[model samples]
Target: MKIKVNQESCIGCGACAAIAEDLFELNDDGLSQAKVAEVPEEKKEQATEAMEGCPTGAIVSE
Candidate 1:
């Protein structure tokens, strides 16, 4: 799976990082960013939760 964050839409709520710290984080710009280019099978579920939990819909998965 692949995941990405729309920086423009991200509100830096930390939900993604809280949900999947291994896969997401807040950058210096204070927006959520995907830490990995590809989502590992083991982390997919958590990534999904992060995506769903993002209030700004900044997270995207494929």
Candidate 2:
């Protein structure tokens, strides 16, 4: 599946990046952004958790 971070809603809490390091990262602006074009097969579950763990619900599946 594909994912993207909603920049407007992100709080730069680093939760998504911390929960799923392979799939998300904190950008230079300190907000989370998807690191890959798609969530890799092995990392899908972790990606989901990261999305769910986002306090502001900024991570979106596309």
Candidate 3:
């Protein structure tokens, strides 16, 4: 699986980072975006949760 974030739709809610710090983070832009590191399979659950928890529906999975 792969993860991606839609910058325009992000609201800096931090739900993704809250759920999976290893996979996501709030960038200087103040929006929730994927970290530089690759997302692991173990984090899929929290990642998905983050995607769902996002108020703006910014996160996506492929």
Steric overlap count per candidate: 0, 0, 0
Candidate 2 vs 3: which has more lDDT: 2
Per-residue alpha-carbon lDDT of candidate 1 for residues 1-62, written as tens digits (9 for 90 to 100):
89999988999999889989999989999988999989989998898899889999989877
Q: Write candidate 2's Cα lDDT for 1-62 as tens digits.
A: 99999999999999988898888889899988899988889999998999899999999997
Model 3, 4-55: lDDT tens digits are: 8999999787878988888888889998778734568788788888878889
lDDT of 3: 0.82
Candidate 3 clashing pairs? Answer: none
The C-alpha RMSD in Å for every predicted model, in order, reads 0.6, 0.6, 1.5
Q: Rank the candidates by TM-score, best first.
A: 1, 2, 3
Worst 10 residues of 3 by lDDT: 32-41
Off by over 4 Å in 3: 36-38
Q: Which clashing pairs does model 1 show?
A: none
